[model samples]
Target chain A: MEFSYEVKDSYAEVKADGRLNMVSAPKLREFVTDVIAGGSSRIVVNLENTAFMDSSGLGALIGCLKAARQAGGDLRIAAVQPQVKMVLELTSMDRVLNAYASADEAFGND
Target chain B: MTEVLAERSFRGLAEAEAIESVHDELDGLWNDAPFVEAMDQMTFTTAVIESASNIVQHALPAEAQRPVELGVDISVRSTLLQARVSAFYAKPPLGQLEPGTPDEDSESGRGLALIEALVTTVTFERQDGTNIWILSKSPQA
Candidate 1:
C-alpha cells in the first residue's frame, strides 16, 4: 500500500491507496502515532483509493482513534467507498468516527 | 485440474475492502457453482477476509518484506461447498476472540464468531510457513 500524509491547515490528511489489511494497519498506526506524537492531534484519513479493509484494518482504525483521543484530539474518516463503508458500518465504526463525504468536508468539520 | 478465476499475491495487505472483494467474487461464483451458497456467504466471506487480513497484519511483525499468499478453492456436491484456503499467518488464539471495540453500534468484530456460526464446519491448520483453512458450507435445511 502507498500512503501520503499532508498537513492541510489544522487537520492531518493521510491519503492511502491499495489494501489496508493486517500487514499495512500497523504501518498506518505508526504514521498516526507520529502525527500525534508531533502534537497535531486532529486527523482525517482519506481512503478514496482504498479498495479493501479487514478486521485488522478496522482494529488499526480503532487503535488510531484511541491514540488520537488520548492525545486530546479525534480521528475521522472520509471518502470511504461503498464496500469499505459496509465493513465500517458492520463494525459500527461509523458511530464514533465522523465520516464526511470528502476530505474537505472532514477537515471542515473542525 | 482446477480452474482459476482469481489469483493474486498480496503483500500481507489484506484489509476489509479486500475481504469485501473476496465476498463479491464468491457471490459471483455462486451462480456458476454450488460450492458456496447464499445463506452462508456473508459469514464465510467475513471469516476468510478477517483471517487473511489478520495474517497480513500480525504474522511477521519482525519481518518487513514477507509476502502473504492467499489461495482459494471451491467445489460443489449436492449444493454443499467445500472451500479450501491456503495462507501464511499466525493463528489467532483458540476458540475465543480478544475483545475489540468496533463501535458500540457496529456488529463487525464478529468475524470469526460469525464464521463459526454460519458455516457447517470450520478448520484451521498451521505448519512450516503456511496456514490452511477449510470451510464447508451447506444450504440451510
Candidate 2:
C-alpha cells in the first residue's frame, strides 16, 4: 500500500491507497508513529481507496490508535470501503475506531 | 456433487509476499466467474486471505531442514465457493482453535473470528504434515 500524509488544521490526514494486508500493516504503523512523533497526535486515516484489509491491518490500526492516545491526542478512520467496513463491524471494533464519512468531518466537530 | 465452474490454486513459500499473490489469484478467479454476487466475492476473498495470512504468520516449520509452504486452492461451483488453505511441512496449530472475544482495544486475536463470520462454514484438518483450513460460502441469490 502507498501512504501519504498532510497536516491539517486539527489532524494529520494519512491516505492509504492500496491493500492493507500483513505485508503493509507494519509500514502503516511506522508511518503513523512518525506522524505522531512529528507533533500531530490527532490522526485521520483516509481509507477511501483502501480496497482490502485483513486482521493484521486491523491490529496496526489499533496499535496506531493507542500510540496517538498515548501522545495525548486521538485517531479516527474515514471513507471506509465495504470490505474494510465489514471487517471492522464483524470484529466489533466499529465502536472503538468509529468511521466518519469524510476526512473533513473526522475532526470537524472537535 | 456440485460441479466446479472455475478454479485457481497457488503454492509457495509461506511468507508475507504469498498473501499478495494469493489475493491476485482470487481477483483473477472472480474475473473468470462473474456470476457470483458481489457480496459473496467480497466475503470469500476476505476469508481466503485471512486463512492464508494465518499460515504465513503463525505456522512453524515441522522440521529443521524445511520451511513451511503455503497452498491455496479456490474453486467456484454452481452456487458454492470453497477454498483449502494449507500450510505444508508445518507443526500442529497451537492454542485453542475457537475464536476469542478480545476487548475493543486488542488487535491480534480477531483473525479466526473474522474468518468464521465471513464464510458459511470453516473446518480444520491436519493430514500427514500439512495443516489445512477448508472454508465454504454459498453465494447469495
Candidate 3:
C-alpha cells in the first residue's frame, strides 16, 4: 500500500491506495498519526483505490479515528469500495467511521 | 466426491508479508474461476484472509526455536467455496474459539465474528501440531 497526503484548508486528505491488510495496517495508523501530529486533526482517508481490507485494516482506521478526536479533530473515510464497505458493516464500524461520498464532503459543512 | 473447478494453495512462514502473498493467491484463484458468484468470491476471500491473519497474529510455536508456518488451501466447487487455513508447527490456541461481541469502540476482536458472518460454517481441528480452520461458503443460486 502507498500513502500520500495533502493538507487542505480544513482537513488533511490522505490517499491510501492498494490493499489495506495486516501487512499495511500499522503503516496506515502511523501515517495518519503523523498527519494529526502535524496539526491537521480533521482527516479524510481516501479509499477509492483501496481494493481490499481485513479486520486488521479496520482496526487501524479506528485507531486513527481515536487519535484525531484526542487531538480535538475528527477523521472520516470516503469512496469506500465494496469489500471495505462489507467489512465495515459486518464489524459494525461503519456507524463510527462515517463514510462520505468524497473527501470534499467529509469535512464539508463542518 | 466434490468437483473442484478452481483451487489455490500457499504455505509460508506466518509473518505479516505472508498475508499479502495469500491475498495474491486468492485474487488469482478468482481469475481461474470467474464462474463463481461475485458475492461468494468476496465473502469467501474475506473469511480465508481473516483466518490466515489470525494465525500470523496469534499462533505460537509448539516447540522452542521453531517458527510457525501458515498454510492455506482454498478450492471452488460447482456450488461451494472452501478454505483450510492452518498454523503449522504451532501449539494449540489458548483462548476461546468463539467469536466475541466487542463494543463499537474496540479496534480488534471482530475478526472471528466477521468470519462467522461471511461464511456458511466454521470449524477448527488440530492434527500433528497444526491447527486448522475450515471455512466454507455456499454460493447463491
Candidate 4:
C-alpha cells in the first residue's frame, strides 16, 4: 500500500492508497506511529482510496487508535467506502471510532 | 503501490503484509453500487488474503528474502465472487500446515481456520515448488 500524508488545518490526514492486510498492516501501524511521533495529535485516516481491510489490519487500526487516544489524541476515520463500512460495523468498530462522510467532516469542520 | 484494478498479480510473499488490508480493500470493492447490499466479494477477498499470508509467514519464512511469487484474480460469475491466489514459496515444515495450538488469545493459528470458514471451497496444489491456492466463495444470495 502507498501512504500519503498531508497536514490539514488541524489534523494530520493520512491517505492510504492500496490494500491493507497481513503484510501491509505493520507498515500501516509503523507509519501511523511515525506520524504520531512526529507530533500530530489529531489523525484523520482517509480510507476513501483504500479498497480492502482484514482482521490483522483491523487489529492494527484499533491498536493505533488506542495508542493515539492514550497519548491524548484521537484517530478518526473519513470517507470509508460502504464495503469497508460493513466490516467495521460487523466488528462494531464503527461505534468505537468516529467515522465521517469526508475528511473535513471528520475533523468537525462542518 | 499495487493498484488492484479488477484484478492484480502480487509477485511475492513479501507482499503478504498487504493482505492484512483485505478487509477494508474488499469492502471498498464491494462498496460499488452494484453490490450495495451484500458481502459476497468481501468474503472471498478476505479468504484469499488470509491463505496467502499463511504461506508467506509460515511456508516461506526462511526463504522469504528469496523470490516468492503470488498472483491474484477476482471475478464475479452467477452472483458469486471468486478469488484465485497462486503463490510460490519454500514448502512448509512437515507439520506447519496442520493447524496450530495457539492460546485463545493468540492470532497465530487463525489464518487457515479463517480462510476455511470464509471460502466455500479451498483447493491447494503444489507443483514445481509453487503452491497454488484457489479460494472461492458464494455469499448468501
Per-model TM-score on C-alpha atoms: 0.62, 0.98, 0.98, 0.62
lDDT of 3 at A58: 95
Candidate 4 chain A has its poorest 10 consecutive residues by lDDT at A83-92
Each model's lDDT comes to 0.64, 0.95, 0.94, 0.67
Model 3 chain B poorest 10 in a row by lDDT: B35-44
Which of the predicted structures, 1 or 2, would earn the higher DockQ when compared with the native? Answer: 2
TM-score for chain A in each prediction:
0.93, 0.99, 0.98, 0.93
Give the number of the best model, judged by DockQ: 2
Tens-digit lDDT string for candidate 4 (A3-104): 888987888998988776776678888998989898986899999987777656666777778767777888898899865676566555677778898888
Task: List the candidate 3 regions with Cα displacement exceeding 4 Å.
Answer: none
lDDT by residue (A1-110, candidate 2, tens digit) is 99999999889999999999999999999999999999999999999999999999999999999999999999999999999999998988999998999999999999
Best by lDDT: 2
Interface Cα RMSD in Å, per prediction: 5.9, 0.6, 0.7, 4.3
Candidate 4 residue spans exceeding 4 A from truth:
A107-110, B1-39, B60-117, B121-134, B139-141
**Fnat for model 3?**
0.84
User: lDDT score, residue A18, model 4?
Assistant: 74
Q: For residues B8-53, could you state the per-residue lDDT of candidate 3 as single tens digits?
A: 9999999999999999999999999998888888888999999999
Q: In model 3, what is the error at residue A51, expressed in angstroms?
A: 0.6
User: Retained native contacts per candidate, as fractions?
Assistant: 0.16, 0.95, 0.84, 0.22
lDDT of 4: 0.67
